[model samples]
Target: MKVLMVEDDLALGDALGRVLQGRGFEVTRCADGVEALAMFRRRRPDVVLLDLSLPGMDGMEVLRLMRDGGSQVPVLVVTARSAVQDRVLGLNEGADDYLTKPFDIEELAARLKALVRRSHGAPELRCALLRVDEPTGAVFRGATPLDVSTRELALLKALLARPGQAVGKEDLHHAVFGDEPVGADAIEVLVHRLRKRIQGSGAQLVTLRGVGYLLIDEAMTEGPVAV
Candidate 1:
């Protein structure tokens, strides 16, 4: 699952990101509310982990904007505000669940899973022989299980999420590296690895110059000669 974590605290965000990634999640984080909202629209994460005290815009306004924009994606408010009124306000403003800061990491993870499960059922995604077992975060080719790193799985999942549609390099970077400070060639290297793994799997990863990469079924694209 993809999670858009909107938190201004650097330490907490970094720690949570690492933990969540270990627990079968693709986490992209933004510190500012403005950037968070923009990422929300672009990334279309399965769920959002929102912090009320944010810069540029408060969490309440961000939630309001999301609802205003007709987004029904689940939002979980994670903040230090533990007052009953605060929780009520958050829910009233469109938050699906609330989590007070300093909470247990396991609980947070469970809540995230619950929200995503309720909002979007865990459905397996596929493109030809490349299949993503959403529940276990496993990638399979036909009856064989293919070994893929977390980053590779993230990239493949992102492409498979939208079959036959080209995904931009920037978006792929966000999905794979999140906010990590990697080199410009990081994505290229990752793509090269995945392109090799999916070879002869009936799925082709085609690169569109100046656009990005897309996954398509090779069998579906083949046609008879036009005489």
Candidate 2:
């Protein structure tokens, strides 16, 4: 999944980014709330890791604006503020989960997974005809079984969850490769192979020139080209 981490502390940001990336997340790190807001609008990450004490526009303000603008993406507030009122305020402002500083990265990952799962309105990992049991890394397409690697399943799950949206190449890269940057050709190769596998399954995977790929359901194929 893709995450936008809004943190002012460079050291902490780098550490969290590296750790989260290692744990299978596409992370975009922003040092301040303003930049976070801009990136959030552009990318619309699956989840947002926001810090309450941001420079210039505070994280609370950013969350308020995001809600006001009708963006319902899940947000997890990671901050040093541990007060009850502080946590209450952050929740009231639209954060799905809160994590205090010095938190375990594993716990953060688990919380994020829950938030993302809830945001997608699915009790489990499912998208249209595809269903994935994350714990066992099992996958099924409709009633037909398909054997897919863990990384490929991750890619498919991400794409299927946001069907019809043109997921950017960088975001996909982050989702699969995380901390390690992989070549664009690698992404292309994976998508190409995935397309070939799903070609006759009534799903259309279209490549947007100069942009990214879109996984479209058969019903949405006639809509405008995704970009």
Candidate 3:
């Protein structure tokens, strides 16, 4: 799992980073709120560990920006502020969990895992015969893993995250291409590629014309199953 750790304390961040790495999590460290928010927007992480006090921008403002931008990635606030009002404010800003500073490392790991599991809902996401193993981020058809590129997998995960909804082209672009500069029809091209890749899985990549794209079970769109 990937974790974006936003902490300004050099020693603390290093120690926590090592611990998280030992627990098999890929951690990206950022010292300030600006850099953290930039990284968050460029690519989605499994979870975010945010500190309330940050330079460049405040952690609360970062939380607001994340929520306002419609990113549903779970965030856990870790700070020295243990007051009830502070906790309440963090939750109101869309943090899924909160842990004060000087917390147990083991408990922190447990909370992070729980947040990821809850955000993913089930271990597997399904549509027709296609599935994604949330724990592994692997796309599968029946018992076989589908051969797909990293970008393809990212796009698939994004669509599956909001199944049946027309995800805007802009959002898909950010999810797949990130900060890379691409042409106007870049998302369309990627969608076309993904559509062909999942063709055997009985899932359809549907375009919403002026809207964007969505995924659906082809079987569901077929009428009456021939009765």
Best by TM-score: 2
Q: Clashing pairs in model 3?
A: none
Q: Which ten contiguous residues of candidate 2 have the minimum total lDDT?
A: 218-227
Rank list by lDDT = 1, 3, 2
Candidate scoring better on lDDT of 1 and 3: 1
Tens-digit lDDT track of model 1 for 64-151: 9999999999998999998999999999999998888788675577568767976866545788888876535677999899999878
- Give each model's whole-structure lDDT: 0.85, 0.78, 0.83
Compare candidates 1 and 2 on lDDT and give the better one. 1
TM-score of each model, in listed order:
0.54, 0.55, 0.54
Q: After superposition, how far is residue 199 of candidate 3 from its true place, in Å?
A: 51
By TM-score, is 2 or 3 better?
A: 2
Clashing pairs in 1: none
TM-score of 1: 0.54
Expressed as tens digits, the lDDT of each residue in 77-168 for candidate 2 is: 98999999999999999888888888866557756876777777765655456666643346677777778765676577667657557888
